[model samples]
Target chain A: MEPNSLVKLNEARRERQAAILLSEIGKGRDRVIREGDTVAGPLGEAVAKAFRSGKSGMFELDGQEFFLNVQVPAPRIVVIGAVHISQALAPMAKIAGYDIEIIDPRTAFATPERFEGVALRADWPEEAMGDGYLDAYSALVAVTHDPKIDDYPLIQALKSNCFYVGALGSRKTHAKRVERLKEAGISDERIARISAPIGLDIGAASPQEIAVAVLADIIQAFRKRELSAAEQAKGAA
Target chain B: MSEQKLTEHLAGNGPAKDELQVAQDWMREGRNLAIATVVETWGSAPRPVGSHLVVDEEGNFEGSVSGGCVEGAVISEAAEVIESGEPRMLEFGVADETAWRVGLSCGGKIRVYVERLG
Candidate 1:
């Protein structure tokens, strides 16, 4: 590659990286870095790999070497209730590299002492979710088991691009909850996105175990969505 | 590129962006430099592929292709690449005796491609 072109390429890459990072979009586009040739392309495979794995790497396509540098936003977990399960879930999620926010109107339960080191919001779900708090990178878990607390957030999650939406309840409870959502004008397709009974059915009997199950389910949903998005981008390319 | 364009690019995020800015700065100051990128890895390599290490003519460097395991060798080779203006592909693995000498105790393999940056 010519010195001038190399400079141009690097500048373009930096611009794209900045845009993705500032937006917390976790997306990047880079071309094959090669010697003597101006080998540039969409870098579809690299983009997809970076998006799915959240790890960047270099790979050869058709014998040409390409470097994929990805910057993924920190994944976030928004728990709708500051209950016992949330107490377990918050710390565990933090250990797994997720920024957690606990929301509950009940100030007693949402105290800083109960949920140390985690962001606590003693406000209604709708109020807490106002602007930049919720996005595609966020996972919403409604563990309050209260329709007033969990339902509104679940509806908001469905309306937005939240990757995962889970609500803690029994099968019977979820059925009734679904009927209530229908009455609230939430479409059946959108309501279906909620993972009712909240977590992976690991037969969890304690708050800690349930938190584990919920975290596992959230990760599963996140990975699956990333894979699908990568596939879609590849198809479009 | 213009100074304004360069500044705009540096305003972006990520470790790679920072590395690129450093490279550009060193180049502007007339210092010869080379970049070594992790092109591939096998088994339990510490750093992911696309990880980078930039080396200047005086052996000053930043970033990592194999964490602390094989960076010493990469930096050494990178300095040579800067002087020679030649590119080379380097590979290190547990099965190789050099791997043990370089502290690749994690029993993984990594391939790094070294090249001069304009």
Candidate 2:
């Protein structure tokens, strides 16, 4: 092979090596949870508990308790609106470890200049939310507050295991939206997943406050599931 | 042991270790290891539940279960448990002065379980 090809090969090898190294560390981290069943009985149980609730579990060894949760990868935050809240929220959500994606049909709002380094999708919600868009590790926040755009994604988001689904609107607005969703055939339970009025009641008045409320609600939803599961397990027992 | 540093590591793209080599090292070591996990927390707990720290026979450690409060105590305890091939439940809280002396600042309490892993 030529020298250039050799250099290229060497670089490729390093890249591949790095990639493998990263994956291996991840595997090592998970091995106690995966192959852990045969080796450690309680580690497997801890992982099972973590998977069920996405929270950590405690294991007792040598008369001492150790706490661990399944290493849950951060959820993907796909915002279907590039409004002011999105501007404020995308950065905060990214800081919170959400893989943030902002979608808007308007070029002015959706441009790289506006979002800079953030994932910007200049497409309709229906289009942007394609390809198994929502997953267990996804939180869909509809700050667009425009029904024409927000409704479709809300419907689509309800069809997945999104951990948090929130939309910015008042109770009256949500009620109207719910009526339309009902007309569109959305069930009461699925519609219930949406955090309408969108946020913890931090007496939020500004766009930033609203974003904080919305993020707070999302975090609460994430943490609440763990509590609910524990309650369920206790009830079962 | 810094909460911010650990979150930064986990929240970023992915892990920074080699898979085959780590797997081979694990395979070579081939003994059950005990993993202590923090499952839940509230109110200024040193570390939230779900914090993790793993230990083997050699006293080598990776990860943290508390901000810095009880890891030393946990590690020493975990090594023996890993060797004995049994599990134990550990709790740390500021319910009393002794508990505070263990350094659970903020009066927070956490429950942890440590079990051996193969």
Candidate 3:
């Protein structure tokens, strides 16, 4: 069958599964598991085991079994500089499902008031971004062009498996910053991943516009879209 | 099981079969019903390709293909499908004037299959 037809068939099959699951409601003798129920203890263990194996299981309830599956999506966003762009980017990123956290040494800049709903860490970048702070899904942005702050975090961010890493600067500033990054031991290949002069070339101007560009770049990175030669060069080195 | 548990299970599982079973049951029970499914999408379509919506004889709808733009037309077509006993593939593109009237942000095109599930 054609791919579209196959998709339709698969969807039909899924619909059938939903219908079966719905029909199973109240048809079994056993009850749905509630929190802290001893009867569900074994079933819960089995569910956990199944989840570890990337699958789920069916539990027998009064001679009938019902399948149970659980999926947990990982979420984390770490902004290296508590700049105005970070201020704008944090909320929008949160809306996109990231658990936002801001790390900067400037206590005045990183505060609860500016990032009301976000987690704040007013520690030096090198000290704040500890082990396990950066993960595979973590999206990090270095907007504070201050080398004292941006360079250290860039190294740490490159070392970690962050899904998106973008830096904000003018082209000349980024070029100089790249030289500094090289001095600090980031290879030409590894440093290529940084989206310096970050964001789509939308001619964005103000801090808000810059934030928009940065977020768009991150979205593009997330989608793994075809990048421009400049973007590819920045991403590869 | 209590009605609460039943409703909870339905909400949690949210499987296509659950919706299909509901739709098929309604269809078998002599109710006119139209089922709309997203078959293809390009660009930044709001919903995924396999999203579904089922409408009853009276034009009541469950589920969504998008925010709203294409749904009105889709629901209308779905109702016709239920009445006519024929399946129709309705394609809406961002560039389509009617598409913007409904609210597609981008020019992503999507194909919706409307069939009388009965």
Q: In terms of lDDT, which candidate is strongest?
A: 1
The DockQ of each candidate is: 0.21, 0.14, 0.03
Candidate 1, B83: how far from true, in Å?
Answer: 7.2
Model 2, B26-112: lDDT tens digits are: 435674455666655656676666456766667666766764567777888889777775666677763455435544456677766
The collision pairs in model 3 are A15-B16, A15-B17, A18-B17, A18-B18, A19-B17, A19-B18, A191-A237, A192-A235, A192-A237, B69-B102
Candidate with best DockQ: 1
lDDT of each residue in B21-96, candidate 1, tens digit only: 6777778888888877776789977567767787898988876676455677888888887777677889987445
Query: How high is the lDDT of residue A191 in model 3?
Result: 83
Q: Over the stretch B1-118, how does candidate 3's per-residue lDDT look in tens digits?
A: 2334334433545333344456655655677776676656778766665567888878887776764557778888887777886667678774566446544457677767666653
* Model 3 lDDT tens row, A171-233: 899999889889988888778888878888898888888888878787766555322334434
Question: For each candidate, what is chain B's TM-score?
Answer: 0.73, 0.65, 0.70
Q: What lDDT tens digits, residue by residue, belong to model 2 across residues A1-237? A: 112222332343333211000011112222223211222365445544555555544456556444443444456788888888888888888887668889888777788887879999999987777755775567889887789889888888877666788888888999899999898887787788788788888899999888888877877776555323343243223
Could you give the DockQ of candidate 2?
A: 0.14
Instruction: Please state the CAPRI-style docking class of candidate 3.
Output: incorrect
Report lDDT (Cα) of residue B13, candidate 3. Answer: 50
Candidate number of the best TM-score: 1
Candidates 1 and 3 compared by DockQ, better number: 1
Model 1 lDDT at residue A145: 84
